[model samples]
Every structure is written in structure tokens, then in C-alpha cells.
Target chain A: MTVRDPFAMTALDAVRAFRARERSAVEITRSALDRVARHDRAVGAFLRVDAEGALAAAATLDARLAAGDAMTDRPLAGAVVAVKDVLATRGLRTTCASRMLEHYVPPYDAWTVARLRDAGAVIVGKTNMDEFAMGSSTENSAFHPTRNPWDLTRTPGGSSGGSAAAVAARFAHAALGTDTGGSVRQPAALTGIVGLKPTYGRVSRYGLVAFASSLDVVSPFAQTVADAALLYESIAGPDAHDATSVDRPVERADLSRGASVLKGLRVGVPREYFGDGLDADVSAGLRRALDQMAAAGAELVELSMPHTSHAVATYYVLAPAEASSNLARFDGVRYGLRADGRDLRSLYGATRDRGFGPEVKRRILLGTFALSAGYFDAFYGRAQKVRTLIARDFTEAFAKVDVLATPTSPTVAFKLGERTADPLAMYLADVCTLPASLVGVPALSLPVGLGASGLPVGLQLIAPAFEEARLLTVAHGVEELLGRLSLPSLD
Target chain B: MAIDVTPARVRATADLARLDLRDDEVGPFAGQLQKILDHIAALEALDVSAVAPTSHVLDLACPLREDAPAPGVLRDEAMAQAPRSEQGAFVVPQFVDE
Candidate 1:
């Protein structure tokens, strides 16, 4: 059956249709590919579209379903899943949007990618991203910028911009994104979709191109919180390949039980997140969400996270310090595109000089300088101390409140090229989302309302580490109470 | 404190990193590096003497598994994208002349 409204169909609905044989997996995959063909020219969501590979995978899924197989054995069978280019996929060019590895094709899949494949999710293609997952907009990509589906002139937030945009534009039912200082949630907020960055260690990192190894996380973006949770469950768990992967049972989030009023749930609104620099529209949207929660039987408690302001400063230092070490592997020797030169040293210099884009080189230089021997104690060391205080702030806040709420970003999607020239301003775009990353908290970004410019504003719900289930439940409640139907039509 | 990423420091870092920079690049890179260092110098202003350092977010301790020969990508496939290779291994010029 042809899927004319694939964007409206939820993940659960897609799975049911596929299992009932109402629609073949090939048809669904083709519909998504067709959408990509029509919209990706403007949105720039995908770096590569594996038409032949996607069709082959869909054919296999169709065969499995036709053989009268039990659908219960595969939770995500026949679903289309797009992965950010940062995550490695066997034989696919995983560029991470950097020219250094432009021609690189991995021989193995990342742990999460392998899990998704085992769950029978079709690997549609790799999406665009900021080089090394650094920038707040996908414009940092060496290739092209991913435009917001809501307004083509505006940016889809980055470095997971392409993933969020693809799902928002109906190019894929759901997509995987990496969250390093709000890459996943910020984009989800900008594009009016569900993005979840699970607690640190909750998901495996094996084979994912490293940016800041400690702070980076793989997350999911979907049209609904339940769909994001479904994708999250399939890829989260212990993996021998990733030492940081948590050895815990997957906490299944059941949103189908219906949205229950968050009675007796204590929601904390951090005073620091609502301070100066927050746009009037964002503040209004967040306040409206909080008011809805209060009316729905949840207690809105005024909380203080004094360390929130230092998050941006601390993140800039720590992320780069870690990046300096992690990115050292990209020298001319490894498997990737290399620039030729007369000798070994010249080869290394030319490879890095020509291969990396401006943003990537800037970050590498900053990181290297920060970690240099004389400056290490003054820069990298101080940031680490601030990190401790940031984490402590969350630990204390969670003791008094079950969840924390804030505006996902200070403003709606800005016009492309607005802040591209100003690196510091681009960094500030991640202000509200960075604290959660620093504290290793589970956070979800869901659309609250439309901004003055008619773009969607995101409200972030945060819970203590390993509390993804509670976070999703609280988000689901807020989503129902808002009742502001802001979903855009892709047709 | 005022600091400059001078040509001398650039050369030092490039040597440490084993990269050769052209003379023309040295001057431009030095100016760019100086501006970045100036921006990052803000970190030095924070007071963190009593606070404990946090390098990683997870409270991880010995999460490593026992040593075993786990499956890995084949050597040929792994090296397929390498720019220069010889005798089934990546080739680099010798660091020191014989």
C-alpha cells in the first residue's frame, strides 16, 4: 500500500500495518525514499541515501512477514531508521560531516547500529551533521546546511540537525542522533519533534566517532515521545564493545497507557534557566507549559540551580580538552581521505590542513591549546572542577524534585547564516541544554507551542540519571495538557 | 594576562605533533591561534581550588571486560580506505634516517 501520510503515522501504527500485511515493508521504505528525493534538496537532511541497500533490506523484511513469522519476536521489525553520519555503519561512508574522513567507510557497525539492525530496523542512510558534532547548527557541516522543515530559510538545529529535520520532513519514521551538549534535544526542539538524550552510560558508544567521549550520547528523534522511547529501548543496554554502556535492564516506557495527569508529581522550574537573554516567546511558552502542569495536578516548585550559568563556560573547556585527545586518531595514517605531500611530516600537515573544515580546525586548535602542558592545569583542570559543581547541583535538585523543566532553547530557529560568523553566539544557543549534559541527566525535548515567528518552541523535561521512564511519563503528560496541535504537514 | 601564539610556539606544537607547516602558513596560523588562546583564557579566571575535578560524568570503576579475542573487522577491509599502504600494512616514511 502507498503511504501518503507516513509523517502522521506513529511508529506503533507502522509496525502494526507491516505485521498485518496491510503494507509491505518495501512500500513503506520506498515512500520514505520518495519523500527524501522530493524534500532533501531543500532540507539537506541526508548526506547519503542508500536506495539499493534500503530496498534490499525491505525485501528481506517483506519475506519474513510473508512467511507467517511471529511479530512479537522483533519489536521494531520493518521500521525505517536513519542514523546520523557520526555513527559507524559497515560499508557506508560515515563522514561525521568532516572532510578528513570524507571517503572513509567503516568495516564494522557501531554497537547501537548493530542492535537496531538486529531489531529488524532498516538502515535508510546517513544524515548530515556538524563536523565532529561541535556546532549548534548543521552549517558547520563541511558539505551543506540542513534547513528547518517548518521554514526553509531557518536552520534545523545541529549537530543532529539532519536527523531531526529528516524525521520532521517525513524522510524517515525515526532517526538516531548524538547528543553532546544538546545536539539531539536542541534540534528536536527546533524542528518540533521528540528527542531524548538518555542518562550517560544508558546507551553504548562503541564505534561512534568520538567528540567528547564522556559527555557524548546517542539519542533518538521521533514525531512522538512514545516513538522515541521505542527506538531508545531497542538500542540501549550493556555492550562488551563499550565500557561505558550501563549494565541495567531496559526501562520500558509505556505511553499507550494514556496520559495520566501528573498528580503529586513535583516539577521544579530552575530559576537560572528563565533569566535574562531568554526570548519573550520562549519564556511565554515555558511558562504556559508549567501552568498547564500545575493545572493538571503537578506541583510547580521554584528551584535554584546556581551552577547552571557556568555550564557553557565549563563545557567549552572540557569538551575540547577531551576532543583534543579523541581526535588525534585522524592523522594521515588511518583509513580516510588524505592530502598528499612530499614527506611524512608534510603529509600529516597537508592532510589535516586540507581535510578538516574551518570549524573542525578551529576546535582542534582550541582543544590542543587547552591541553598543552603549561595551560592544562589552568584551563582543563579548572573546567573539571566546575563540572563537579554542575553535577552536584543536579544531585541536590533531584532530591527535592522528581523532574526539572526549562525552555529547550532561548529562541526559535534563526535564519541561516545569522550566527554562523559568530562562534561565541552559536555556542550560547546550547546554554539551556548544556547543564543536563554536564550532569548526565535524562532529558526530553517536546514541542510546547509555536513562537511569534510561527516556529515551534521546545520545552525540556529533565530527570535524574537513569530516570528516563519518569522523564517520558512527565513529557507525555505535558504534551497532552498543552493540546496545541502544532504538527506541520509534509505533503 | 596577555599572550601571543607566536611563530616559535606554533613551530614547537607542530614539531610535537610531527606535522610540517609551510612558511607561508606559519604567520597566518600564528595570528589565528593567538586569537583563540585569548578567547579560551577566560577559563583561567575561575576559582576552583577546593572543588574536585570531574573528567568523566559516569561514576565508572573498572567497567572493562576480561581480555579476550573478540571479533573485529578483517585487516584488508579495515585498511581498504587508507591512502597509502604496502605489504598489507599502512606505510609511513621512517622517522629517522638509517
Candidate 2:
């Protein structure tokens, strides 16, 4: 039963319809804008919705289509995509959801944004996120928290909460999200959408506001694995602007391969990821999904990542350390919000003090202490060594199996302000997603089933670096077996 | 060695970070910092003396772009985002002593 509303269409469907001329890009974009007008007040998924710009672009595409333009090469033709505010969009404000750069607009598009436009995708708006992509829940956003579409009272797990929520709410067909630790996958799991964090160097990070440079990667949130793969392929590639982007060409995935491809697939279930901390309902859901795969002819191997408990601790230390340095550039003189003071020193201090949020301030302090004159060896240096050990764990595990499976998050979407009082509890949400990030490998979060609270549970799949095609192929198999999770009732 | 997260140390670190903290923020930050540090102390149990630090996970080194100047973020375009600017230069409080 089609909902008749264009917002109900997945990006793949929308593109096919556009190609068939069943619906104009204007119709699809207007439907999404209407949905945003109706529901965004409660969901808070978007920081800014570019309705006029989106419609204008869509109208242009419609006009070209009317002229019988053969746009077969454009896979994302007329698909409305929401960009995480952290990415630079020319003329549009890219806030990073932080007060520091609230009014900042980039002169040039991020490499990915430019690529998206090149692929015939219309950017609808900038989605909200945790301030500087620093928090596990969108509550850290200076503007407001993006509520889970599944239930308004709960969080859409975050720093990519708004992006995931936008896709889940059908406000945007898909969205670009950055994962540093669990930002993309964690939120994707909670919101019941597919979120893929490509290998660290797979996607260009030129326009993504530096969070944790070493750990940061841009990915996509969509209803289907195919849509996610489409967005992933478009934005991922080598760029001269970002030297860390791999020099190799992007290896596109054959998403058309169905569940039969799972036969003889060697799937490993890490014993460490299923320890005491995992929620019982989530754990059960993951087991049931794995059993389905096993029944489908995929082999499951039990493995261990002994340093699992150390991941969150290590991530907190290293991410903050990198952030401390990257954030030094927002010193009021170059760009963004600034506060006046009597002297240069006072100006720097005042600007930062007024601009940065509590969470950001806390991280800067933690990072500052970690990299200080006397303690660098014990804190920052030690974390990097531990990082080497984590990478080695992935290297050894992949030798035994094609992919590793685990829970995307320890628990389902927690109530807003539930873990806000205790910061460590909040940090622990990233435990499952952090290990793969530290290793610079690819990871995808797919909705396996729902938990006791009626919210979704996400099963994470990890692959070796540059094995995104393999990762998505396996994900496509699982998605076929699991079927699509129903959209949440927004009333 | 036991990590000491004293209020004085928190104050000093914030100073080094070029951030000014309120009187109340220092105490809370000191407590939270100590807790996070204590958790991070778990790393002390593992001996990584033989392991080398990984600054970047990718095996990339010195990727230099063409030195040729192409039109980049124009001065006016860049200045548009600046909170305070004058005549193509970012305006800031004087640093050198008069």
C-alpha cells in the first residue's frame, strides 16, 4: 500500500519514478517539504530546510526532463538529500550545531557536497547534530535534540542524530553523516535506518569540520542498503584537498546481489561484543538475526577482541586530544563567533568561553590535560599505542572471517536526559562502534529487529579497510533476510 | 604514578587551552576529569612499551598538491564569515605592546 506521499518513497524508488516520468522532481521535493512542515517541529531533525532552493533545483530538473533530457547517468537524479550541518555547503550556513560557528557559511562546497550536486542530487537542508559532533545523543546540539521518530520522548542516538532522524521521518530521502566513534552507526541503529561509515580514508574529509581528524569519516543514512550504497559511491573518492583520502579509485558495490550471496559467507561473531553490558533484548535480537543468517548457509565463528573494554577509554582520550588542536583555529579572528576583550589573550579566552558549549569545553579541558607538558606520555601517547593494538586485533580477526558482527549500540534509544547527568554512561554508548573506528575499518549498522521498548535494535557489520563492497554485499544479504523495518507512526 | 586531577591542575590546563572558566566550573570539571582519567588508567595495565604510536592509520606520507595558485576562497567571500573585518584583513585586538 503506497502512502501516495512522495516522502514514503525510498531514494531508489524516487529515482526510478523520476526516470520513468511518473513523478517530477518538484512533486517529490514538495512532498518532502510538506512532511518537514508537518513533523519537523516535533522531530527537530533539521537546523535549516532549504525548501525554496530545493524546489528551484527540482523545477530545473523537471524542465530538463520535459525537454527529454537523457539523465540516465545520474543515479541520484532528483533525490532530496539532507546534509549534516558539519559539512560546508556554499552560501548555506554550516554550523556544526555549535554556537562557535553558528553564522559561518563556507565559500566552497565540501568535496562530497560538490559530488552530490554533480550526481544530480538536490540538497534539501542542513540537519542538526551534536555540537561539533561530540556527543552520543543529539542533546549535545546547542540548538535542540533531534527526537527519535520511533518515539518522541527518546533520543535518535547522535552526533548524526538529525541526519538519521531525517531519513527515518522521511523528511529527506537520505542524509550525509560523519562517524567519529559511533556517531553514524549508533544513531542509525536507534532510528532504524541503514548507516554506513566507510573506511577512514575512503571518503574525503575536506569540508567535514574537523572533529577527531584521525577517526572522522563521512557516511550515509537511508532506508535501504542500496540507497546508502548509492550515496556512499557518489561522495567517496580521492581528493587533493584532503591528503588522507585514499589515492585508489572507489570500488563500487553490486547492490543488486540478493540473499543467495550469503551462502558460504564466513561471518564472525566477536565474543567480546556480547559481554554483560549488552541489553538483553538487543542481544536476543542479534542472536535471532545471526541464526537466520546461519540457516541461510552463512558460517558463524566465535572470536574475541580482548581489548574491547579499553575502546571507550581509548577513544575519549585520543578524540579529545585531536579536537583540542583542530579547534584552536576557531580563535575569533579568522571566522565565526567572537567576543571582544581588552587584550588579545583575553579576546581568545572570552571568545572560546562564550562560544563553546559545556560538553565542548569539557573535551577541550580533557584534551588539554592529556597533551600537557608533563602528562603527554601517560595519556595521549599511551592511547596511540593502545590504538595500534586495536588495529592489530581487526587484522587478526579478518584473517579468520570475512566480516565481524556485533550490536551497534549496547542499548536501545535511551530517554532524553537519561544519561546526561553521568558523562561516562553517555560515553559507553560508543563502545560497540569505537573499535572499528580506531582500526580505520569500514562498519555498517542495519536494523535487525526491535527491542522490548518497541524501539529498533541494530546489528553492526565490520570489514577490513577498502572492503566496503564486500561489507555492503553482506549487508544486502542480511537486509533481504531481515526485510524492511516498518516506518514509525508519527502521530 | 597516580594521576592527580586537582582543581589547580584543571585551572592550569584550561589556561593552557586558552579557555576561561567560571569559578564554579573548575570544581566540577576537576571531578569529572579525574573520573575519566581514572577510567583511562585501565591502559596502564597493558604494557605497550614496544609498540609504536600510530598518528595516522593510513600508510600515507607527505601528499603534496600542485603549488600553482588557483582562484581560491576570495578575500571578500572569506571576510563575509568573519565576525569583524576591515579592508580585507581580519580585525583583532593588538598583540604587540605599544
Cα RMSD to the true fold for all candidates: 2.3, 1.2
Report per-candidate TM-score of chain A alone: 0.97, 0.98
Highest-lDDT candidate: 2
Best of the candidates, TM-score: 2
Output the worst ten-in-a-row residue range by lDDT, candidate 1 chain A.
A1-10
Docking class of 2: high
lDDT at position B24, candidate 1: 83
Clash-forming residue pairs, model 1: none
Quote the lDDT for A221 in model 2. 94
What tier of docking accuracy does candidate 1 attain?
A: medium
Candidate 2, A1-491: lDDT as tens digits: 33377777889889888888888999899888988999999999999999888998899888888898878767798699999999999888899999999989889999999988878898899999999999999999998889999999999999999999999998989999999998999999999999999999989998899989999999999999999999999998899888898888788777677888789999999899998998888999999999999999999999988888899889999999999999999788888989999988999999999899989999999998889888899989999999999888888999999999999999999899998877878997789999999989999999998978799999999999999999999999899998999888585
DockQ by candidate, in order: 0.54, 0.83
